[model samples]
Target: MPTPKPSILIQLDSDPQPSVFDGVVAVDSGVEHLFRHGGVQPDAVRDLVYGALFTRGPADLQRTAIFVGGSNVAVGEAILKEVTKTFFANFRVSVLFDANGCNTTAAAAVLAALEGAGGVLNGVSTAVLAGTGPVGQRVARLFGRLGARVALGSRQLDRAQATVEMLGQVNGGRFTPFSTSDEDSLANGLAGVQVVVAAGAAGVTLLPEQVRRSLPDLKVAIDLNAVPPLGIEGISATDKGIDRGGVRAWGALGVGGTKMKIHKRALQELFTANDIVLDAEEILELGRTTLG
Candidate 1:
């Protein structure tokens, strides 16, 4: 009888508790022998990655993979860099960086917004509230890559600009920064926008129900906050494909199903190849395939 292929996944998380959400998804995606590490620092990634790299031979390396995640995308990114630095030639296992599920969540949210916008995203004027955040930054980046005129919003204009600059460095796409601290400012930032996505902090309302209802040009509205006083008010957590005032709206859970689907599909894609590194753009492409 042939020996069974090992399906081991090494999860390196920066949080104290290795994300229960990621763990559940990894298990559900058919990962066997998941080794989870919490409170992982960038400096410690070398040892952890080495552990995974050295244990399996090149041919058997497909059996092992790495997942970098945490609540903070910055730390997760630092860890991702360190993890990649440890890889040499064909001796590395496939690794995925989700960082609080930002990559998959943003991909799912973008996909939802495009669908809500009548299946058109190019040339659409879009605003990402709390655009300096991990998820918001990714959403803006993805939209910009898709040829959307993206406005990245933040409580402070400087921070938004910094995010826009950072995104430019990586993707060389155009992005506008706006301050959304007050109603007038947020309204101005969202003015003429066809798509509005609220990715603000938990339990904080970025766009009030009145504001969203009053928008004249808004065709799609999406909120990533599942907490009370959702990022975008007037949208229920369970709402999906609901039309309000001629605008399609999606709440957190509405987009969540898509996020979960993308997550699982990305994981399945990981196992298909030993050289795949599923990041934001790659994962977004996978999500787009699901749309068709």
Candidate 2:
């Protein structure tokens, strides 16, 4: 009888820390050992990842895959590309990227909104607060692909415009730009919007309580901020798929349970096949299977 293959997880950090492994371990499985590093620059990650693949042996290396995530999505993207390019040169391992949990979490949040909204994300006018960030972009893309007119909001008009342009290139859908630095701007963006999502930084209030409460056409509201100060004013962290004022609300942690479940399932799904990119769109479809 052959010995079972040992699975390992390599965590590369731009800023090295021992605690970084905890974040990945909390949600993933089959990881026999976890390798962590900090202060890993783009130029060095290729060699680092390559070394891990070769040293793990073919069986272990075949089971080996890389997941890139960090506070900075750009940094995460750079590292992810390097790792993938290097691995493709000599190895057949898979790679996944989701900086700040943006891709996966955004997929989950939007799927929840679609579920709470009763079917298609099509023809819906949606506004995303703090829409310049990584998670926000993924949400906007997913919304656009599903047929929604998206208002990508940011404090800077340039950032909002950039996001709109990017989404057009990738998904080829109509997107509006909004600057939500003041109450009037936020309200203007939210006007006639059916779905609103707050995916800003932690503990920072972007959407006011009054705005969430007053929107008549708003059918679904989601907040992806888990820290002390909520992102969407009236939505509580505990409000998962809860209905309020004719609109359904979901908080960071509230939407997180479904995100975690989807993440785990996504990993298992990877092992069952050879070439699959489980980005926002695919992840949302997986979540839809369970929605009532």
Candidate 3:
């Protein structure tokens, strides 16, 4: 009889302190052992990955997993690429990159909006305000993947356009750049928008109540800021599927439940295969399938 292999999760974080929130979720997600590494750089990834790859045979590789996370998504992305480059053939472990809770949070938010829009996002016109950030870009990408005509809105039009062009290289979906800084820009960008997501920094108001009320085609509104002065003015941080002025609204806390679920599931899934990569699109699809 063979002893059962323990499931171990190695979390590599760019920040000086690895995320305690992620550690707690990994424990809750049934990871038997967790190795947390902070201040991780691309240079450190190869040694750690080699350690994960060499300690176990190919058959037991699924028991080990890698999670790349940090406050900065760019740093996390660099580390992820390094981790991938270390693997060849079946000498890899399943990995998930979700720095700053971007993938899970965005997945949950987009899934909420899709549900609010009658389970159909095809042909829906959507606007993702603050789309230059990690969560917002993912929201826009997910919406576009769902067949929505997505507008990536930002205070700087050039920044929004750059983000759109970056996302276009990976996905075949169409994304338009739009400005959402002022009243005129908001009105212009949000015209005929059926769904709106406010994924901005905390305490910064992206979409005002007046502008929200003015959009005739707005069917769903999602605000991912839980801090004081929520991102979307008219929506409460705790709102979930509440209809306010003919629009189904979802707040940060409202979307949090699903986000946590996706996070946990992504971690648990790491032990299921040694070849899967759980990124934005993969996490979005996972949430959608589980929710459905």
| The best candidate in terms of TM-score | 3
Off by over 4 Å in 1: 1-4
List runs of model 2 lying over 4 Å from the truth.
18-28, 56-60, 273-277, 289-292
Q: Name model 3 segments beyond 4 Å from true.
A: none
Model 1, 232-289: lDDT tens per residue? Answer: 8888888887987788989999999999999988887777766888889999999999
Query: In lDDT terms, how accurate is model 1?
Result: 0.89
Q: How far is 229's C-alpha from truth in model 2 (Å)?
A: 3.0
lDDT of each: 0.89, 0.76, 0.93
Sorted by TM-score, highest first, which candidate order results?
A: 3, 1, 2
lDDT of 2: 0.76
Q: Give Cα distance to truth, residue 64, candidate 3, Å.
A: 0.3
lDDT of 3 by residue, 170-266 (tens): 6784899998879889889999999999999999999989988888999999999999899999899999999999999999999999999899888
Model with the higher TM-score, candidate 1 or 3: 3
Instruction: Specify the poorest-scoring 10-residue window by lDDT in model 2.
Output: 18-27
* Worst 10 contiguous positions by lDDT, candidate 1: 266-275
Count backbone clashes in candidate 1: 0
Score residue 11 of candidate 3 by CA lDDT. Answer: 95
- What TM-score would you give candidate 3 relative to the actual structure? 0.98
